[model samples]
Target: MTRPRATVVSLNQRIRDDIEARIRSGEWPPGHRIPSEHELMARYGCSRMTVNKVLSMLAAHGVIERRRRAGSFVARPHPHIESVALDIADIPLEVTQRGHDYRFQLLSRRKRRPRRGHGPEMQVAGDGSLLVLQSLHLSDSAPFALEERVIGLAAVPQAQQQPFDRIAPGSWLLQHVPWTRAVHRISAVNADAEQARRLQVEAGTACLVIERQTWRGEQPITYVRQMFLGEAYDLVARFAPGRPARRD
Candidate 1:
């Protein structure tokens, strides 16, 4: 029999959304434990069953996690945020959700200033900053793409804590931090010696290049060049048949 005049389902959804928002906002990171059922029940004035339903749903969706006796907690290590498009903004959460054999390698990192010769456009930055991070994105242990990224140390100071071996550069950036704005440019080019060798493809192979300029409010936050082995990937874009397209 159903209970009458109770805020069970509604409360479940409310708490669920709250937890999801926290994760998206980077308050709750990967592999982090979520509140226990008892805590959630008390927090929301709901029953244990209500909290259990919400948590079960989240686990099914690959968001938070649940353990037998350890209780529920946030998932702080799931690598989500790569498979999504550049424009929708949040990418890390998506990458982590995709249960694929993925890996990353850090090639280089440097603290430097943008070259003056590159002109005022590239030279401009908040706090006279730039942290150059070079990395390689991989799937199933095979090199997939090359990343050349410039980070604004002011908005995200811990840019150095990124572990290239465990997180894709894109996933790492989105999950651990937040951005105000970003400009992504995708193009194609023929692979050079270094690119070809790393990608295990023949020289002159066509490759897709993705360039991004990110911002924090009005201040630019990052500039990134992501090069992909084009022949192996197909970038897909989906939309409603009637939704108006957004201008870049």
Candidate 2:
């Protein structure tokens, strides 16, 4: 049986979705040339303007590239993004699950004024004192990650008293605070002398950094930076697109 054709009004959008599906499914992998506008126009029975419009949107979204005299091809695969879980991660459990002995050392715990730029970042009223915890995570006795965190006392007062040595601050905060939101910025950096010593890597080594901020309603709960030796880790994320509702 033949599939019913799309309506005129939905043609452009359906065409766009079909093209994107091919790219996402790796059918048209990076560097693969997509059909020309004329070819696509004939295949989809759409006007040139509609096809061009769809291609422009794809290019703007970095899914395809248009080159003079070269037509368009799938763009080189960018850092793929998958929806991340908002819940706090269990670092020790993650390490142990990966077949390694997990351990951590609480290097320092102190109450200090927020750094020059931290006050605004934390959305606090003043450069007030914050509980800072510095720790090192190890996998099978090898340095895995270094964590530096600052807690807003007003948001989680118990942070001031908790000895993070017994429970990682991340785990502690997840258990104590009712955070409604979180933001994560993942990036690569060249480890400096200080970070190098903390992660037990040579200076100038590449590292993966996760700068995370958590909030309870409008109040900031904590800001932490977890840096790991890049050579020792592979960050993975999985994404599943939303399915259309069933008519039945």
Candidate 3:
């Protein structure tokens, strides 16, 4: 009797799953080099094309990183960070969850008209005036994040009446307003002098910035820019293979 050959699809998935399992289980830690294509092909009794496809998929998913002439290795995650889900939550609640005391300090509040050169936050104000707020969030008395926000008076007129002294603006907005949609933009930047002073980090230190805009129906509600120390925070997202990500 002759031994049967495994189908290409089955073998490909098998190899991919095995590698993923090792990485997830910490058997292959971050920066651990993956087996070369030739080695994988020989071990799995598969074609070079199949091994390449598996590696390509893993790289695309961020499970591993490929370097020119250096082969592929397990990817390292950001250091000294707290991973968060896609759905951002209240900052005060986040600090409490981390077993730290949370405090808010309102820096400034002003009402101003939108100007052409101000930026997108100002543009969201349309023809109406904006209630601008600046605040800082502290964890265990240490600077955690700095926030700058502008609320569209036409959309959330009540914001002008409330003094955001004890509570952070983001936390207050989440409670009083019902938003139909929100968009988040994340980036990294070196701290400027003012931001460095507020965040208590070196001027040249890297910071993670999250800019968010929320809307009620077609009307803009508020726009906020939050800056956090890069090593102190991280954002994580999980998704299924072949599934489209949620837009909102």
Candidate 4:
């Protein structure tokens, strides 16, 4: 057991960042096989063990996939939706506590330049990158909510690395990022054909759409719309006379 040298520690992070930058920049597209461990060891002038550790971390984070004797490749991205609670709570836990089996499916994900109309809502100007995700949530096999989200790449660059199939984007951000303020808008809307299909309800059915935008200080973190089936979900809040409720 030997400790990593100071130079080795620095090199490890540099190597990892370089590889990640290449992947995010599309230089190493999804399913692209990265250079072999031996090649990387030669290129970085580091030991095989250091390269292995770096690759392992990336693989564990779903950023890359490594096969036995086959080498590693960038993973294709998965769609994921982020949600916010005016009073933050674990959504899966909330559903389970209510005695329903919770499940969700990814619908779509895209990273592209925002449309001209999206500028004002996201507080951004010009053509900047936006990460969008759509998903459907179910309770006990019944459609519950449809989530659509747009995240600003400038504020959270790591958003590009997340494939939210296993973890909801909202939950992940809650755990990793800190936010200073959030604004919530609740409204009633009729389910359109697409929303109806996703919710397993007929078109024109009533729904509650909860739109939330959260920021870290002044930089926007994400904006999400959660459309819940009118009959399937409820929004609850508790308050005291003078004190504000807890937020996380």
Q: How many Å off is the CA of 219 in candidate 4? A: 0.4
Arrange candidates, best lDDT first. Answer: 3, 4, 2, 1
Q: How accurate is candidate 4 locally (lDDT)?
A: 0.76
Q: Model 4: per-residue lDDT, tens digit, 145-200?
A: 78987888776666787898987777777765555467788999999998888888
Model 2 C-alpha lDDT per residue in residues 32-87, reported as the tens digit of each score: 99999999999998788889998886676466789989999987744433323433
| Model 3 regions lying over 4 Å from their true place | 1-85, 241-248
TM-score of each: 0.57, 0.60, 0.62, 0.63
Select the stronger candidate by lDDT from 2 and 4: 4
Pick by lDDT: which candidate is best? Answer: 3
For model 3, the local distance difference test gives 0.80
Pitting candidate 1 against candidate 3, the one with the higher TM-score is 3
Assess the local accuracy of residue 115 in candidate 2 as a C-alpha lDDT between 0 and 100: 67
**In order, what lDDT does every prediction score?**
0.65, 0.74, 0.80, 0.76
RMSD of 1: 14.1
Cα miss at 158, model 3 (Å)? Answer: 0.6
lDDT over C-alpha atoms for residue 128 of model 3? 92
Better candidate by TM-score, 1 or 4: 4
Over 116-222, each residue of candidate 3 has an lDDT whose tens digit, in order, gives: 68776676797799998899999999999999989998766667768988888888777655454567789999999999999888899999999988764456788
